[model samples]
Structures are given as structure tokens and as C-alpha cells.
Target chain A: MSAQTVADKVDRTDRLGIQQPRLPRLAPLGIAAGAAVLAVLIGVLGGLGSRIQWGLIAAILFVVGLYVISTVVEGGRQAKDRLATSLVWVAFLLAVVPLASLIWETVSKGIKVTDGYFLTHSMSGVVNVAPGGGVYHALMGTIEQVLIATVIATPIGLLTAVYLVEYGRGALAKAVTFFVDVMTGIPSIVAGLFVLSLWIMILDFGYSGFAGALALAILMMPVVVRSTEEMLKLVPNELREASYALGVPKWKTILKVVLPTSIGGITTGVMLAVARITGETAPVLLLVFGSPAINNNPFDGGQASLPLYIYQQWGAGTSASFDRAWAAALVLIVFVMILNLLARGIARWKAPKTGH
Target chain B: MAKRIDISGLTAYYGDFKAIEDISMAVEPRSVTAFIGPSGCGKSTFLRTINRMHEVIPGARVEGKVMLDDENLYGTGVDPVSVRRVVGMVFQRPNPFPTMSVYENVAAGLKLNGRYKKSELDDVVEKSLRGANLWNEVKDRLNRPGSGLSGGQQQRLCIARAIAVEPQVLLMDEPCSALDPISTLAIEDLIGDLKTRFTIVIVTHNMQQAARVSDRTAFFNLSAVGEPGRLIELDDTDKIFSNPSVQATEDYVSGRFG
Candidate 1:
């Protein structure tokens, strides 16, 4: 019956919602090749210096072409949908391009100096002009400083979040929330300056990795609190009520019901905050007081960190130093990538089971 | 053990706005009393006050004397948590703690009381699930998530969680409203069996459900729009259905008007 109606309405197809045949799988490829050819031709005619301009022009042309083709093949409504989908793909590619290029650049330049020997040994005695050095000491300093910052920041941020989500009611909560927002927007350099003034200037303390860690802690706390508060808010109040109805105390309910429910999100939030702070070079540069030699004591002497090492190597302006800097950049990227992967893995493992 | 409740001059408020006006009633031990009313008639509000769950909302307050077998629930120094422990509640939606396994959702309350061995918890979880008439279906998958079950089964899991700690009173706020007819019947049957063990107070919009499950029914109605809801009448379910004392009760029961 539907087929009969469809056949009868073929002339007046726009009156009803009629299904149209889809584009072939190779259609997009053909459109993309056409776009590329057009872009290259225009680039040649216009004498454009940057090859990047060609890629950008091609992307735009592809999106516009897709909508026009879809409109001619299907209808206005389907064309609009295709336009939306094409626009979304364009947006995704826009986001991915910078990251892809950055990773590609790092890998290409970093492989020159990066090896097993470079990883295990330190730059204790190697001169800036030479090639035999490792990031082991800097890696150690970065780990210790980040770990210390995490240790100091996690509890304060978590407690503040619990207060905001569970028990927040009046002026104090609003004040705390306002301050956290303000803190999040503060420059990392300002935080470093804050630690510099408070710990070094007034207290007469010398520069150390601890000072750098303190600054990073200041940078990390607000992020942790904000992210944690968001995660906590995502926990439905019904769960809290369910726990309360079961005679669970408020604190116990928070610990058992609320926290466990949002544990996956909370872990992801914390890792994101950690990732945000890991590559921060400003505070590390300001407070860490870079040293080439291995420093085991973070509290007493100057130390090395990944970002600081990268900065020093890059600033040295030598072929060898540039190689070292690129290698460190590669290591930092891989470190952050691993942290991201772990966060997602943990989130999946702890995600609440919802359905059969 | 079940306890008789005597409430006198009860009033509930959300900030400055009164929700339920001066209400009074008595509930017998080990019997089902259903509160039937139109929307915003304070049936849910009044039910929440019985266990101090009403105060969970910000600016929500109650003025009343709720005597639970001679103990004043709203009296000075009375802990709301302890009151809630004695008077457990099931909500309108089936909230079976999506984060927990079927076995864990049942054992949650018992664990809150803090002294049960794993073996004791196992026994109580099994019994509670059986009491809710969900044991046969979920017994094999007790380790699975509670949310993995069907909606009706999740509600039963919630029921099991509520009853596991053995509260004297069980308050169900439109427990079957979110369920289908078959699921509603299943819950009604479970409520029937549960009344033998504990005193049950339920708020329901469905007149037939009230008539079927409740021994006594209370009708609540608002005097006018924006006015506090008042208790119109209370009597045996049959009498309330056949011939009510109040005009509004008769009209509401007969579907003349809400």
C-alpha cells in the first residue's frame, strides 16, 4: 500500500516525506579530488607561498560542493542535513590538523637524538655542543615536582568540591566558588610570582623544585575543584535521596553513593587537570632554577624538569641542543598522551553499569 | 516490628508558602493506608514529613506532632536519620542506585547500620528480594547491576533495598505511577504481602490501585488554587469508595472532578 502511494506521489514527491537513494561510497572521494584539483590550480594561478592555504581552500570547497551535489541528487532538506554533516567534519578536521601536524613535526625532529642511551643517561658532564645526554635527571625532577603538587592539591580541591556540592547553602559557598573561578583564570606566571614572593622574598627561602611544586599546586587546585564539582553535580540527587532513605549518614552517603557514582568522571577530571599542569613551562622556569646536573633533593637545591630542559636546550641555539629540545618535546607529548589514555581506560573500568 | 502512628495538627511549608494545612490522622499497625488526591494536594509532602524526608529540600519545614508509638518524631533532639531508618521510603521513580549490583543495592541499607557480617547480609538480601517477589528472576544475576533489570524489576530492587533494613513503616510515593499496568499489578501484589509484616503508607493517583491495595484511604484536596491542601476525609477504603463523608471525596472518587 505504501509502495502504491509512493508510486502515485512520484510526481508530487515533495508533498510527502519520500526516501531518496543515497550517494555512492566513492562520491565523497570524487568530490575531494575535484576540490583538491581546483585548490591546486588556484594556488598555481595565484602564486600562493604557503601550501597550507591550498589545504584550507580545498576544505571549504569540499563542504560547499557536498551541499550543492546533495541538493541536486536528493532534496533541499537532505542537502541541509548533508551540509550540517559536512560542516561538522570540517570542524573536526580543523581541530585535528594542528595536533596532527604538531605530533608529526615532533616525531620527525625528535628521532634524531632520542634513543635508549639518551633516555637512561643524564646531561651531567655533556657540553651544550655535544650530542650524548639524557633527560633522566629532568624526568626525575618533573615527576617529583608534579607528584608533590598533586599530593598537596588533591585533598584541598576534593574537600572544597564536596563542600560546594553536598553542603553548600549560603554566602560562604558562593564566595568560595567565586574565588575558585578567579583562581582558574590567574596566569601560571602569577602563581609562580606568588610563590616567589611568599616563599622566597618574605620567608628567605632559596629557589628549589619545592617552590616550583608549590606554584604548580596553586595552578592545579582550582582546576581540580572545578572539574570535581562538575563531576559531583552530574551525580543525580535521586542517588543521594536513595542513600538517605536507606538511613545512611550524610558523610557516608557522599563517600559511598555520590562519590562512587561519579568516580569515573572524577578520575577523568583529575587527570585532565594533571595534564593541563604537566606541560606548564612558565612556573617551572620561574621557580625551578634550572640545573644541568642531577639533583635528588627537590627541597634543597636547583632542579631540572622537562619543560625547563626543553626551554634551555631550545634557547642554546645549537644543532645538538635543538635535537635535545625536540626529543624532550616528544617525550612530554608521549607522557601527556599516556596520561590521557590512562584516564580514559580508568574511566571505562570504573563507569557505572546501566543496562543489560 | 510495625508501629501505630498518630499525627496531630501537621503543617508543611516550602519557605514562606504553606504546602499542607493543619492535617491530623491515625494509622494502625501492620495495615496499608493510601493517601489519594489531586496534583499538588500535599499527599506526597505529608507522606515525606512522616519520616522527616521533607526537610531534605532547602527551605522545606514541618510543624506537627507525629507520634510513632508514643515517641515524637519531630520533638527536640530527635535525629532525622534515625527516624528515616525506622520509616523507609520508595520514590515515584524506580531509583535502584545505578552504580550498584542487584545484591549490593539490597545490602546497602543493612550495611549502613554497620554491624552485619557478609553471611548476615547475604541472608537479608535474599529474604528482602524474595519478599519483593523479585528473587526468582534476579537470584542468578544478583551480582549484575541493578539498572540492568527491566523498569519493573528495578522498582522491585528498590523495594528490596527499602525493606532490607526492616523499617517499621514503609512509605511509597506514587511507586507504581512510573510503571505499566502489569508492573503496577506486580507492585500491588507485593504491597499486599508486605502489609502483613510492616505498616505501609502509600500516595497514589490511581483510584483503583488505592481501592485494591489499601485497607484505609485518606483524601486530600486544596481549598482553592494557591491554598494549602487539607485532608478532606479518612475512612476504610470500601466506605470511601462507596459513600464518602465529604462532598469533594465523593466527587474525586467517582471521577466527577479532581
Candidate 2:
């Protein structure tokens, strides 16, 4: 065939063969709106009381409607692709909804009572039925207890992780690995009870934040070890070999090369462990024996922590106490959020400068 | 600082598998000796054995003698760390410590040995980078991360890192295999310059590279698949390429078969 005729035939086939019918760009949004409206109508007609039930119905309808419409317009194969995409989105929203709602509820309700006055004043003289209490004593106790726990756990966890990754070889390594796994699954309350038996029952130590810190340390150690181990394993074997070939001893290589390379990840892990143990109330309740007055010395006497304070305030069953509980809960959330942000900042700061 | 290497009846094993068996050879001081072989022939394994790097692998061991000058590397009471200090190595792909700066990568070995004055470290780093022919390019950006460099520059940086400790012998395992032709040529030139100061043994698959950079060439082969690799021939590079005594060496250099 002539080249011109052949070119024309190719153009006709390209136009006919490649393109397929697709849903409009705004179709998903349109479907979601329709599903929400229909879900509300059904909820009203069926006399469903909760808006949460309406939301769940709308989500299910959105997914089902998208699949049916896409299958009709874009074929079964494209419909399946859209189905997978919508499922992932639904799963993401499912996870995000409760977290967003919790933050929203806390901020809206707690804003009334959480202010500079609430942060700076202690609840020493305030009665549970009346208002005018703050989280000052509890915040101080939480900070000191968590700090002591971090101090106790970090070095032990780091050393254990180093031993596991660098030198762990035979049955001993296997045993240690098994114990770390077991320790990771230990309940926070069990850790509290164990400390209660040892520190309070056996050692005859009085209720103190230090006792609570020991329990928090137990809960935090395995988490730190697990995370640090994963980060250490991520350091390339080639880097170790490189250090070894430099005449550096095994310990020096680990200290200078392996640890430095994974330090960012390790710090982030430790901070996450701290965040996890910060809000643990069972250990604090059993060991520290929540106090109304501020206690500066964690080693000496009873202290109040944020979680324990929240628990006590809610149990009082008064409107003013409920407000204080919500405010304390918000303060706890903000504390955890701050820790997470610090973790991210340290991770970025200490990350290996691999790129410009 | 160059030292002659005398290896006799050397055998290396990984777990229960014999990787290389009964290899014996002598590499002269201040010379470039190239190891050329097909894949899985244990050329790299044999090179690692010279510096006691083979035993770093779990359950991997070596049985034989590798003497540098008068000291036997596998002898009793000889620390592997000190042996590694005397013998430096560059890997196939560039492995500059990702967390270290270019200057720190070169100064890493020096720092491990003992405390060095900052001036001394600067001098050694600059000298080593110059020796690797990387000084002119990286001198201005010595504080930049070694990993930020291009592949060729990173390989050169690794070379500088190896030489900064002033090792008696330098071992390179296919250092140019991961580079483009231009980078390979740059390394070839650097190797030629480096042989004047250190006894260099390099493993490579490229016959042309072997001819271009080496004074002596060792050819390695195995009898069949799953068999332990052995040294087939060691001779002058020109003789190996043109008129090798072994038929297998001739076939390999001429690209007849692996």
C-alpha cells in the first residue's frame, strides 16, 4: 500500500481501538452526595436515632452504587478497579473518622475549661462537686514519671537491640528474642501489679511517682527494643563490612557506624514508646495513688498523673468534674501530639544526609 | 608501604559448601594483579580471603596460609582487625558510608586507629582523595555526604577511603563493574596510579579491563556446576591474553566460552 494510505489506515485504527467509555471525572462525588441524601431519607423513614448509623449507611451505599454504575458504564474490569479503589478509600475514612471525631469532641468540650488558669493552678483545695480545678499537679506528675521511665528504659532497650542485631548467635540470642516478644505482649495492668508486689508489698516503699515510673518502664522497654531492633536491621550489612575493613573493632563499628546510621529511627522509636506509656492509667492508679496536691519529688510521695486525674474526675459524676475530665483528656492528647511532633523533628534532624 | 602476598594451599568454605579449594599464588609488591573469572568461580571469595574478610560471614571459615611480607595473616595471635588495617578493600558497588561526609568517609579509618589532630586528618583526607584522582572534583564540597556523589565519584570516594589508612595492600572486588565505560576508564587510570604506592589485587569480569590495568592476571574456573572453583592460571597479563599456556585461559580471554 502507498505510505499515505497506510498512515491514514493506522490513524483510523488508533482512534477506534484505544479509547473506551469512562465515567465522568465528578462521578464519585456525585455518587457520594446521592448516597448521603438517600441514607438520611432512609434513616428518617426507618426511625433510626443515631447520626452515626446514617453515616455508616451512606458509606456502604456509596461503595455499592459506585460499583454498579461503573460496571454498567465502564465494563466489569474497570468496575473491579474502581471497587478496589473505593474500598481502600472507605478503609482510610473508617480509620480517620474516630480519630478526627475524638479530637473534635475534645477540643469543643474541653476549650471551656482548658486555659492558662487551668494549666497553672493545682486542684489541691477544689472539691469534686464544685469547679475551679486545674491539671497542674497531674501534668507535673505525668512529665516526671514518663521522664524517669524513659531514662530507665532507653539504655537498656538500646543495648538489648544492639546485642540482638550485632552479636546474637545461638540459643542465648534465641531465648532473648523469645523473651522480648513475650514482654511486648504484657498487659499494662500486669506490669502495674508486678511493681505493686515488688515495690509496695515487698520493698515497703510508699506510694510514689517513681513506683509508677518503674511500671511504665517495664511497659516501654519491650516496645523500644522491638522498634530499635527493626531500625538496626535496616542498616545495610555493607556498611558494617565497610567499617570492619577500616580496622575498626566490632564494638567501634557498631558505635560509630551502625548506631549512627540508624539513630534517627531509634530516636523516633523511643519517642513513640514514651508517647504510648504517657497515657497509661492502670500503673499510675495502682502505684502512684493519685494526689490532689502537687508533688515535686517523684521518689518521695503520692502524685497525680493526667490519666489518673481524668479517671477520678469522671468517676465523681458532676457537671463541673466532667468538664475538668474533658479538659484533662485534651491536655493528655496535646501532650502525646507534642511528643509525636518532637519525634518527627528529631527523625528529620538526625537523618543521614544522603541527599543535597 | 607495598607488601608482597604469598598464599599457599588456601581453601575457603561457607557453611558446609566449599567455595574455593586449594588456591596457591604469589602477588608481587607494587604491582596490579587482576583476577578474571566467570560468575560463581570464587574470584571475589579468594580476594576476600587475602584480607581475612571471608570469615566475617557466619559459619564461613578459611584453612590455609596468606603471608604478607614475613607475617602470616592466618597465623595464631594475629588480630583480624589489625590484618584488615594492613589490607584495605573496595567493594563492587560504591559503599561510601551513607551517614558520613566525603571528608569523614576518608578520615573514618584514620579516626578509628587513634586520635588525630584536625590538621593531620585534613592532610590525610586531601592526600588520599588526590591519590584517588577525586580531590579536584570533591575538594570544594568535602562536607557533602559521600552518598550524594554520582556513582563514579562515590566509587572514587570509596577508593580514597580505602587508601586513607595507608594500607600495605589494596584489594578491589570488581570496583568498575557497576560503572559506565567512562567511569570504568577513570577507575582504570586511578588503579594505574595507585599501583605505585600499594600492592593492588583486583577482581574483574571484563577481559579488556584486565588487559588494560593489570601487570599479572590470575584466571579462575570450575570443572562443572556446583563444583568448587580453582585457580587455573596466573601469568603476565600480555602472555595471558596472547599466548596463555592453559587452553581454558586462552578461551576465556578470546571470549570463546565462560
The C-alpha stretches of model 2 lying farther than 4 A from their native spots are A1-12
Compared with the true structure, model 1 gives a TM-score of 0.96
lDDT of 1 by residue, A121-203 (tens): 77899987677798888888888898899899989999999999999999999999999999999999999999999999999
Residue-level lDDT for B186 in candidate 1: 98
lDDT string for model 2 (A117-206, tens) is 999988999997789979999999999999999999999999999999999999999999999999999999999999999999999999
Q: DockQ winner among the candidates?
A: 1
Q: Model 1, B1-258: lDDT tens per residue?
A: 999999999999999999999999999999999999999999999999999999999999999899999999999999999998999999999988878899989999978668589878889999999999999999999999999999899999999999998999999999999999999999999999999999999999999999999999999999887899999999999999999998899999998983
Q: Which pairs in model 1 have colliding backbones?
A: none
The DockQ of each candidate is 0.80, 0.80
